[model samples]
Target: MTSVSRYMSYRGYQFPMLKYWSPSLGVTMLGVVGAILFLAMTLGPKPYYWPTDASYGSSPPIATRAGWMALALLPFVLGLSVKANMISVLTSIPHEKLQIFHHWTSYAMFLLALIHTFPFIIYHIDKGDMVKQWKTSLVYWTGIGAIIPQAYLTIMSLPFIRNRFYEFFKATHMIAAVVFIVFFFLHCDFRLSSWDYFIASGIIYFLCLSFSQVRTYLMHGIHTATLELLPSGLARVSVPTVIKWTPGQHVFVRFLTPDLHLLTAHPFTISSVYRDPDQAGKAPELAFYIKPRRGVTARLAALAAKQTGITKKILIEGPYGGVSTHHMSQFDTILVIAGGSGGGFSLAMVDEALRVSGLHTGEDESGQESRRRLQVVFSTRDTPMADWYIDEIESRLSQSTTLPGSDNGFETSVSVHITSKPDLTRSTSTLDSEKGTAGKLPPTDITTTGSFSLNIYRNARPDIPGLVARTVAMAHANPMPNGKKQRIGVLVCGPASMLHDTRNAAALAQKRTFGGEIEELYLHSESFA
Candidate 1:
């Protein structure tokens, strides 16, 4: 076998288990949390500090200090919970990664609450005034109210419980959080100095959420979205909005017109072109490919399907995510791997690579012309999805070929794999000879009908590692104008297993020097869960 073929079949290197946990984010969080804890324990003014050896003597001041620390953590926990978070805006870190710090800080706050609770109780009991303290002080009762929910919140946040009952978890978590905040402030008796952080956290959350809501209203003005239910149990909802978003970013959508659960918004990746305007001076239209799963999506689909020309007043919360943009253009070649609905994210990136390459000109930081090779691999469970997305894939590829400064735009390839058997019982006897599928509507004839080609694989899935290796090899072998080291960016948005495979392949490639001695590989994943 040829060297290219040999390299493609080789299973590459795997990193140690700890690397999979995203060590950089972990390390950063550890340093920050440790510093905060150390300062809280050591540097704060100890107003109740005493040289007394008695346990009851130190309880009041230590508990009060811990209470302060717990309150201080509230802003960060709330900040990280927001989609349009200030920390992410400042740091340029994905909000998803920031969630790790959120979880840890919440635990820290819970620990502090525990620490804050026992000492005061010990002091009250030691003085034989426990019952009197509870009866006389609103602080004692309000503190109990705050601590109980905080403990409950932590219990309900366990991964297995959360994933199983997400809606319940979300509702209870929100309610409990609000209760905790209120009681926490009251527990401090609304002392502006002591309760200021909780108030700040509430303000931050309100501003972020309200800003997102107001922006959407300003752009779309209580927009009506047209929902068309497709045969594949997927519904396409298209809405015209004034805002433009980067490819692969998602918007949180709520169907205000729907009778069922109109308040709960769900995030869906924009499946259509990022900034396409159908006419001059018209609002850019956005589209979402939504599967009819349980909850709001399912209800929305059923409601839309029953009504002809269904239009709903919708709320769009954001054009969030797509942090991959920070480094996508730095690479010479791009490989996008996606599965099922996750194709929404991958396809957007594919479109972005094409759009930027066609539109970009002049020199880069390295004084090299804009040039890139894009390879798209989409795997789906059945043919209907494949058919729908494949048409979109072809249209985008064809559009790229004709765009201005697109001489190199045709340097793209699309491979679609369908894992399930086609419903051949519905197939017509006279199969379209041009397209391989025997069906009522044959797949697109890429050679005859499109400027670019699409390879459709049925009853099989592409070997993720092998395909990645071959693509990396091809990119490495191709010569760049400036002869700088080739960089390959592998962007995956799919099931966890698919992401794991793609990440593994990218990691393997990074270890080896490809055809060139200094070939580099970077992997970015968009995870819905």
Candidate 2:
């Protein structure tokens, strides 16, 4: 199928939205420019590229005000979106376009703000004599602070520079955002617009952001958030969520504590839909069955040691863009690729599938007659992490043996691919001791009737070829159930690099001309990195 059909069939969104939102930014370009035009039209002559309002000193330069409006627009647009979770607002745009908008608008904000500062700068440069008094002026200082963020923001906006120094860029990018917000309050002297759209926008941003903070604060009073290690190595964290998850999505995380400065919230694909709706004052509890990492996962480990209730506040905001397959009809073959923490999301889907597997399989199977296979490829860098949940896995596997209404899931197929096992400088137990355990899955593997197995290795680089090997081994295992187009769909989540390669692999595999038959493989990915 063509890209449009695939997207329309899977995502249930207008085809134009994806193509325009594609890295080349075909559509967002027009939208953003149009927004700029509207602002310009409301303010002056140059409605597209130039800022018409240059007046300063009086109240706020019209240009300055408009710049604030634009800066504020991003979060405002986000606040209203169903996906607005403070945790991963960065997930709003596609990678390439995200980079473009993140850079350009930021630089534009900086330039506009800087241009708006011109009168002040001219006035001050005229009087280096009045430097001391000028520097103390509220407007002057606020503009200066804004300038500080602008400089860093501008530097990071450069593609090559940002690529070269991504860590510093990310950190500074976040810092710049906070700084921008601070300078905004100073710019407005905190009263906010006081009424109308400006006030409404400001309030919305405040409530959206502050809601997360206040909810967490009330839940976990002092010691930072707690991480409860569930029995199956699935860490149960009661994050402050305002509502139910839309399913098949993930978010970025950051620690609330001061000491763990680098203890950012790692992105974990959300596992399940929020079951309760009427629960009051209770922020949604997000779940993650994390595959332990050494240095990076230390904070989660620390939380696993919690004795009673939540220690510190945990921030949660997100229902980021999720799987395209959320809307797709249940297909014949569903190949899910979960590497490391990626499994959190896929396993959640599998959990849902396992519960319904019997309804579609064996003697009494019904709706799933059209669906033939349930294939999963799990690429992990740790082996024992698998051991951590093997009990529950085995239980599920056994459950497959005895269908609720029948016997032996001779109908479906299940496969797990363990791509690698890296040396963990730290262990899950050690981490568990520090942070209290959350919860666990049962002790059983998931097995259907055909080709159930686990493949393991210790490779330094888990590349496309390796992934292709495992996936192909699973796909061609039984000749795609007698001549049906192989029709495989993949959902991959892991390191961004690995996900990209997996996508490439899936594409490569689909391009081949088979013997008297044709097959198509579809790939999807979620990146926490």
Top TM-score prediction, candidate number: 1
In the range 205-271, model 2's lDDT, one tens digit per residue, is 6766675566434643332345676554556555545555545666555666664444444455676
- Model 2 ranges off by over 4 Å: 5-104, 115-138, 149-182, 185-197, 207-247, 250-267, 272-287, 291-297, 303-329, 359-371, 386-395, 404-451, 457-488, 504-523
Instruction: Report residue 354 deviation for candidate 2 (angstroms).
Output: 2.6
lDDT of 1: 0.70
**Model 2 lDDT vs. the true structure?**
0.51
lDDT of 1 by residue, 335-368 (tens): 8889988877776787678666756664556776
For model 2 the local lDDT of residue 383 reads 55
Cα deviation of 65, candidate 1, in Å: 4.4
Model 1 TM? 0.80
Candidate 2: Cα lDDT at 301: 53
Look at candidate 1 and tell me the lDDT of residue 485: 68
